[model samples]
Target: MTDKVLALVTGASRGIGRAVAERLARTGHKVIGTATSESGAAAIREALQAIDPANDGIVLNIADAAQTAEALKAFLDQHGTPEVVVNNAGITRDNLFLRMSDEEWEAVINTNLSGVFRVCKAMVKPMLKQKSGAIVNVSSIIGTTGNAGQANYAAAKAGLEGFTRSLAQEVASRNITVNCVAPGFIKTDMTDVLPEAQKEAILATVPCKRLGQAEEIAAAVAFLASSDAKYITGQTIHVNGGMNMG
Candidate 1:
């Protein structure tokens, strides 16, 4: 790899995305993180500047096709193609299958699944031209285990995993790898709001007896996006603290 390879991470305003962006920047990547709003983008830029002055962030709503295209075009024009892409922008609208509204399902699917498709589509062509790139998608344990009130979230994540495997096969010969990091019960803004009793009940199911940290997931993402993982592709690395082991 070059001394300063270009890397893109979506939803980098906070949580695991921020951690991944920081880790990549520390490892010498010129990171370009993304968020949906100006404030979020500013946060990403500020966080990344602590590591490298050249690293910055952009505004991108991956679920919006036109917005995604415009953002990617501007970014590509300014920074060339990213050597590593992390699809971490996602949303969840948790509701039981019986009560899940069309809007809820579409929101989750469009953002989590289709948004990833759009981001990968924007990056893969450039990656194919470069003939060397790595794409790490952020997935969820609920995708495999199936949560009761997260039908929409689970479906989108499961779809993402399938998409990753298929795209990995398509690009492996081009020297690009596609993989996923599925995290379970990670400590984040979402989990922080859970009631203490609920949190304790959740921890009881995990052999580790604790929640995973954002940095922990970031470590897995870093590994998958590095040259050290060159031999790995079309795989999902679970970072759930033994909550759902194979």
Candidate 2:
């Protein structure tokens, strides 16, 4: 049997999720990262395998309740309960509140908010039985700052933070810590496509005058998932380069 801590990271295909998965693997955890598509899963598997052969990847659509339940059950039965779970899968349907279609709002809410609920539901019982675990959900600065053209995204992330707090209270006695890492303007593909003027406008607002790196965000998550943070729970660690200091 592997001696490494077992960790599950959702949305490991790219960006923050990929960084978090790789960070956990390099830091001595046997990570199983998830992606919604087969190709994305394979990519994650390859990247994680390079770090440690015990690390793996799988296709898991957290938005689908049946699939999430079945796949998570199989993973638990086969690999035993994971010591850490990172809910990093999320989507954004950017549009002005008045212009947003019902589908756009529902899709973001279902995948971002409901999806997390499903994942936590599947893992919390196992963690309770084991009496120890860490759950770190990735949130966003938009949730707190209320960005324009991102109402759905903001609501989902805000809801996620609230959920983290409540769940942490419920499971604290069982030794499971739940927390959130709220990132601001991160240097990801999503931000890379912005025009130079837009990028400059964004950078001007951050006191650090730089876009946060995925690795930096991963570091915060890593800390929260580690035993070093055993006493910290139900807290949202803002990693936003000094934006939204509230």
Candidate 2, residues 41-158, lDDT tens digits: the string is 9999999999998888999998888999998998899889999999999988899999999999999999999999999999999899999999999999988988999999999999
The candidate maximizing lDDT is: 2
Q: What is the lDDT of candidate 1?
A: 0.94
Off by over 4 Å in 1: none
Candidate 1 has a TM-score of: 0.98
Clash pairs for candidate 1? none
Tens digits of per-residue lDDT for model 1, 5-123 = 89999999999999999999998799999999999999999999988899999999998999999999899999998899999999988788999899999999999999999998888
Model 2 spans with C-alpha error above 4 angstroms: none
Pairs that collide in candidate 2 are none
TM-score for predicted model 2 compared with the true structure: 0.99
Per-candidate clashes, comma-separated:
0, 0
* Candidate with the greatest TM-score versus the true structure: 2
